[model samples]
Target: MPKDQLLRLQALEAAERRMKIWTIPLQTPNNRGAFLRRFIERVSDRNLHTAVPAQNQSAVQKAAQFYQSCSLVYTTGGERELSTVRRLLADFGVFWPRLSNASNLLRICFAMSAVLDWAPVILFSLARPGHIVVTPAPFYAFLLGRRRAMLSSSNDGREYKSYFSHMVDTFRRQEPSSDVLSYYELLAMESQIVPALQQAYTAADGGIIKNGTLDDILNLAGEAIPRSKWDDELGKNFKSAIPNDTTALRFVIENVFFFAEFFALMDNLSESQLAYYVGWTAVQGLSLFTKPAVINFYYPSRSQALQGHVMACGALSHHYMGLAFYANYIREEFSAHELADVIALVNHVRKFFREGFSSSGALKEFIDKSQQSLDQNAPFPSAASAPLSFVTDSQEGQLNELFRHFPDQKPSIFDNIQSVAVARRMTRADTRAANFRWNGKVRLYYLTDDKRFELLPTALEPPFYSAEAPPAVKYGALGAEIGDAMAALVSMWLRDADENTRAKVYTEALCRHNRPVIPVETATTQVPSWPNISRRELAERVVSLNAAFRAFLDATDGGNQYRLDGYESLTGKRMFFIIWCMAQCGASYGKQKCHDPLRLFRYFARAFECKVGSVMSTIRECT
Candidate 1:
């Protein structure tokens, strides 16, 4: 090789090393845990060089201390602290032993308390603006273990029952109580609930129950519980008085079956039995904050020494203190210049979609309809601002207030976690709610109601994006992401169009061809048959990839100007497609093999000069 090529190879190696520093460790399960631990430690480090506002410093410190306390409690907490937690449960009338004295209302209160502590135990959970969403209970799913296996027909429920029994035995040992239900009875109750939960979890998106009001939900739930009880519990949860007329409050019921099954079970089971089940679920929720033995019980074969502690603590912190972690992360990792570049790139992509759709005679009507919706929706205040911005001062102030209630003197991990939960519950009724939703994730999402996009801070980091990368590479990765979001918005608009308009657009943009079959081994029962890509999905992928490719060409003067250091053998166009394919590599299992959009892009064929009638070129059916 020439000296110039060798020098380029050296540069590529250094870049790969830096990328591996973040990406390679995530390939294996154990290394993934260690990576997360290191990440949390860096986020929690007090000596961060970034300048956080003095007012926000206390909030960041409290958030860090909260994670530290959870780690310490998980590793070193003893029976005394565990006993206090048990007493705390008793105070809420959540007794382990079957206590006949606990009333139906008391059981409801216990479940509500658990919800306030961010460990909801009910089928329907509270959402923003006082909405209640009927969905699967994640707490129950955690107890079942292996969600996919538990939901499969082959699962006999024996493994989950055994796991439940072990959990009960572990908790029972912490505080011995008499008259507790036999593990068999508990398993039977769970069996009845699991089927309904599974139904909700597996319900098809098209089968979504339309949005209704609280009154509609109560009617669907039947007369199992009186309306007064619901009104009282909901009012308490929302921290406001629910009016006699609750038709104004929205209820997003995704699955009606789950609510029906849940209420029927509630009506039939005895009060004492309900209390025992609810208490058990609550105790399991607090298992993370309990002794090492309780925490380790869930890990089983996995090493519990350092990796487990970090993983558990890191997960719990993210779940409970997401906003604080996000604030700290952006302060330390993200730069203003990178944010500006991303914002400009996203705006460019948006402009491309706008102009392309408006100019196309076939899509003109669709764009007109979408433009009307956008004007009417008048984007949410947060969405109206730049898509890629940091957490606001108001958001940080609310976070500080959330942590202010926790005692400075080291409180038990349970106490600290519960305090944060209570604070969140208290502020749920406020008009200016904290904008912590999806701020910590590494993805871009489109808000349909707001007609805007929001890109989280983490998506700007390595593997997905880098400020130093050439325009072609950046467009290949983040540009494609932006295009995908825009495509989704187009699909949403198309879905709302009149039947004639949709049919016309589909007839023009989508053409069906016989999909080739891929052979699978007979023994692989775990793999389900892959469905043919829908016309809408194919259309979206085409629109996304084409828009991204066009944007790249426009940005780099028809893809002739930009080049990667070691990839000089390839043109910018080829590098663009290659990096787009490489970005999704190893992101999922078996998905890329079956559902990769690249195989359907005609541009992919043209970029690499594939022969006619080949798999890549044959995608002309869709194009």
Candidate 2:
């Protein structure tokens, strides 16, 4: 080799040696402390110093020179240094893998570098379902730096950089779309390519009612954009031309105000309280997003109505996932103050929304309408409202009244739920039925008592009703009514009731219900029994099955494929529904049975369109 080549090889070899030496496990009291001590010692002795050619050093050498004077251990303390590195690793993708010993410097560097390589995946991972990624100021700041670096480079990869840069910018501004649902600002403003909506809204002097920015107006004003303003010729020229759902929009307006009030009230909460608020807030988001679809039974089942409910439900589910992430992150680090804040916020939100629940809204509306009709011997209200074209005068007055009552104190989750329940109720009301009119305040009172019964764990099988039959009216009209109440009660229990109260309700609803039940597991049946399944196992199975079916349908059916082959769709739909219910299981099961086997089989039946008459028979005869 030439002299220069020999020198370059020697330098490379030396650098590799140093990398290996740095990662060697230090025998110190704490793993972090050991690393810090080594880093300090190396810095003190200037051991990291590299003698590169003065005139023609490579890019790596230039970068190294820039870092040389800085403390390899930049923070004031060892713990801080370890934490910083760990966060960077977590953010990049090199999360702390389970290991017993400290890694060598080469291994650590390799891991960190791999994490850097997978940064995109890591960022997207933050958007996982039922998880909320809390981007603290420091984390966002770090991302901003990374974004700047990415932007500076003009490679094709810069598009990805731009995408991620947008995400980081949104995070800093507290408008992360990874968790957006009801918030219009979050959906509209966070996009990199989307036009600046807030500026546009302000510029037009409220002339245009943009669909993308609808959430902003509702949040700012406790009403939808006035039709007079939105109906302007210029408004038609802008992006607000889409026909928005008046009912949902009204609900959003009311609830946004409620949320704002609740948040303001919670500003004084302790750290722990805040943490709980974070968790509960996510749960609330889940409930809200899923509320529309879940409450469809009460609606007249029109296509547009169904679509609105489903879309809203999905958006809520997505937001909840984000909240879950935040909750999981903060659970470990929450202080007493945060805990206090969480509890306070939960209580506050719950209290605030009680009125909405008590009103003629949601399930209560269904109940109220039905009861009144029965009182007068009239038919159930089936006529759908005219697309809820706009919020009624009454809603505007109510919102104004609420604002007056809690001018300083914002409404909480309870208030929002109440608003949603009320809004949904409005969507279902019989405008002409004097008997169905409910003018009283709405309250969510529970029918709780000490009772337990073994629920079938699954809905009843055929002879009870073939898969082709419409969903069994087994819960008769009255029973169905009670079941709706039970669902609402159970949801509320998960939110505000005690574990025992929840357990009591679950036991009664499942165990004591008036129905012949099929055993979840077969003991002396014709077919061999599946192994006993844990709740965790069950959850995994359901998620896997849903994913599989979703994939299959996406592949076969034009992405949104899934025709109701009569009740065939019901089987698969029921399976996913079970998964949904199980996801929010809470203390409902109470050790009665895992209910996994039945759920799994049901999912399979739905996916494959298998007839389960014999299976149902076997389940019934198991005992």
Candidate 3:
């Protein structure tokens, strides 16, 4: 290797070592799964060793039993579970190898109903007050490889096809019929369908047909699915929610072209082939709960090896029994002091934004308006105050209540999954009524419709925010996160503003910096090329970071008392930047792009007092 290449490799190795020190927080095993594991252990201890009051124990014990059953099914996948799956499919009028000579429309409805809760085989509909939005399901990408990209990599396609073929053969061995289709034929069909689905989904306008009617859908679908059959299926599924007497009902096809192409393809296939395809979809949906042989066919050993049974089961439980798991987890793990501190930090960051934008010249009016919108819509109820009042609580509770009707011990995991799906369908109306969605992951997000910010409860835990941490650490980690959210809000305003106003804000906020000259190989070591952050994005990042740093100084009273003990040479301001860098380090490991914002603002350089025109001081062209 060349001398320059050797140097670059050494620099990359050194950078990796430095990053590991900062990424300590992210190294915790199954951080998100901790709550579930604790709850499960507590429930087990109560059941085996001690007696808890009956009334208090019901919900938690039921949740524990349900989770255990799901875990057992997932870990000990066998023929019994596969037989249970076949029976459940038969319940939905789906028989493998040969389906009854039902009309295509009826067969489609039956197939859709079978996996309605588990997967949307082709398309799924979401009902609104006077309209419904129908779109292609996400399951296609899971079953077939993301063909647009994977198909280009012939090696990946071949491997995926081989895995898929093995999966088909595994299922075929269980059936006595000789009519099972060859996997190659199925792959060819999938290749044609996947790209068309992708194209329809990603089209410029999304192939949306606004304010359409059932007749309009039939027209788009042509003879593939008739109007009468479609209407009957809709009425059966929706019941009184959509009245037969009303003609005011509207439909929105999220991708009309997908339906046109999908129905056309269905029309081309014989009943036997269509039956086989629909059966394959059902298998794909249940594969997770089937025998380990089938489950591991698609998931490689490396991926499976990363998580143990407890963590894996917890993850699956979270997905299938989300509301019960989330409510229980929040009730068990939420901390009031931590939430209060986070709320205070968020408020401080908001104040920083308000002050900064008030004097931002051309951008002031637009930002103020956006901020006003946020203020008018109050923040979501803090999980600490009301654990069950998150945006989706009521609806989730109603759906969760359905599981209470099931027997204490389900015979099979597939049965439990089917029960959950049935419950979901029963409460589909509540889903349609909901206008806001809530995700409890460890992140902050803006709800556009609600015009308010939500901080997931998990984000208030250690390394992100803790009541015991020093003011500098709190501001460095959580305060910087709040700053990012606020900056995104400003970015949204800029996106919607007139071209002239946007140009003015960009010009006013721009920070010009000199680029440091380095060996090209060393410069590109972390990434193939520098991340392409737009001018507007760079400006927002600068403003947000400076605001956060200013807020930190205010909160700490411009004192240096919060310095780290081990790093006695580092000043308070330097420690603040270090903690902030550490908080973001996990996402940016091996990539220099994450450092661009700080480097552009020269805060890192200023904090460390790096020499002017040095690489740390002058790198990056602009902010």
Candidate 4:
């Protein structure tokens, strides 16, 4: 054989060997407690690095050098330049999935290079969803490296270099929080904007009202953006480069409309009410840091294990060591048969959504569109993986063997946090070196993305799923939740035109509820409201719809019916409803109703009261 062909064959075999080191046997079958004891004994400073067998240790160590040749990159949606990060990762054969301008990416590059072994999961944050503004200094510094493989022997490297050079310029002095500014600026500029709007309206009406007065109302909002520094901060990267470019700003405005809407509500609030809003919100964020004070501030009645500062600390510690406990949780609560059952349940639910959950009614047309939207989520392909398993199996503790939980009261909280920071950096470096190859497996707990779902072991706990659970109980609890998430995925599948048509259908549905009671409810309300006053019950309807689907798959024709189990002397349908309601009943009423003008729904009221003609009640059939 030719020497070149022989060398290539050796490299291919070497790569396969390294891949095997990434995974190892975990857990001892039927001896979960003993397995955990042995597992904890294996904790060490190095975790994922132990994947290699003793015989191949030297070879594995040499192969890990491949991580050294590549660079990792990340910039946010705020930057509007995924190309910067894209090229960096591509240098090492890690190709990112495509994303539209509207889509967001959560790119994490786990570095495996020798220099920064401590850098665990280097992640990217964006301005999407509930993201708040933070200094982009860290992100800026993270992007300062060349990513192309040192000796790719690639066909062309010039274009790649050019992309990198341009990206460097873009990252320079690039304020990451610029996108956040565009969103909140309108609120800060409200005083100027409202007058301008009033003047425009008056001018359009041929001076119908004089001097920017709409019925003598001088309107404004929100404490002038927390100090006169609004323009300098907001102007750093907003609408300045393109000079009057409002495209990115408009997107932020549309997506974060509710933020401004809430600010507008300040007009209706009293001083104390305003204090309550600002004070509690500030406390909630700060509570994690000063948990003891927060616990003490609450009444004595609130003294539960989950209420105290200790509990807050406990939760974080538990998460830091979760993988160590994952095996035990699986052994104690999960089984292979049960896990298979849940997988089957998930598949069944997915199939139901694909078929529009077997609908037939005015809602059916929208359901069909939703299913299509779900099937073809764009900019990236969708595939399901078994992130969860029911615990019918164990071999030997693998990943947990590498983990060491923090010593209690040893490192100060700040020190612990800093250590985590280092670990995360190392993890991200390793992941980057390993690259973004999806091997059809995911970790148990992770933030969800547009492309996939991650099911955790904790999800198997009571009320969600159980090995002994009837199908009805399973569907009523975790099944509903999984179904709800699936429905959300399907909703994204909607075409723009179909979305408008569905909106019209919903508009007409709510129109039937436009009774005289709405105005009375509005006056008693405390926020400057948007329209859609009659749609307050839509949430309840959604909850009802999930219940209906759970009890009998095709409620329209009763194609699949759950037989009665006689729980609480109730039939199958009522048992399912009761279980579902009781599961949600644990939340405090304040949590339910806050930010929602329509009172927190009383589950029993909806399930039993049969309010006038409302659909929330069990009495209102799916049709």
Give TM-scores for every candidate, taking all chains together and pairing residue i with residue i.
0.72, 0.21, 0.67, 0.41
Best by lDDT: 1
Query: Each prediction's Cα lDDT score?
Result: 0.56, 0.27, 0.55, 0.32
Report the C-alpha lDDT of model 1 over 1-623, residue by residue, as the tens digit: 99999999998887665444433313433222233335555655532233333233466665666677776775579887678767666556666645445546434443444444444345444444455555434455444444344335665655445556666675564555676677667767766665665555444331345578767877777786688777665665554423445656676665566555556666777656655666677676666567877665555334743455665565556555655655667665666576667777776665565555454566655544544544432332332355654445325666667556444413357777666655544455322122322212123344435564456554565445787676666787788777767667666677667878776665544443345423222223232332245656666655667677888888888898534444456787876776666555543222442244555565676778754344444434442
Better of 2 and 4 by TM-score: 4
When 3 and 4 are scored with TM-score, the better candidate is: 3
Q: What ranking emerges by lDDT with the best candidate at the front?
A: 1, 3, 4, 2
Give lDDT tens digits, candidate 4, residues 1-623.
Answer: 99999999997676555323211111112222232223322222122233433232221221111111110000011121233333333321221121113211111121111111111112111122221111111111111111122113462544333432332343223343322212123224333333332232222112112122111211222562332233232333221221232222211111122223333444554333332222222222222233232323322234531233332332233223334323443444455576677766666555554443344443455455544433342221111235342232222333322221222211133333334333432232111111101111111223233433446554565445665554445665666656555444333333344655655545433333323332211232243332332332343234333443443444324323333322234443444554454434323232232222122233333434434223232122223
Question: What is candidate 4's TM-score against the reference?
Answer: 0.41
Clashes of 2: 42
Model 3 agreement with the true structure over 257-318: per-residue lDDT tens digits: 66677667666665555555666676665665666666666544635522333444554454
Predicted structure 2: lDDT: 0.27
RMSD per prediction, one decimal?
7.0, 29.1, 10.0, 21.9
| Residue range 167-218, candidate 2, lDDT tens digits | 2332222333333222233223224211222122112112222232434533
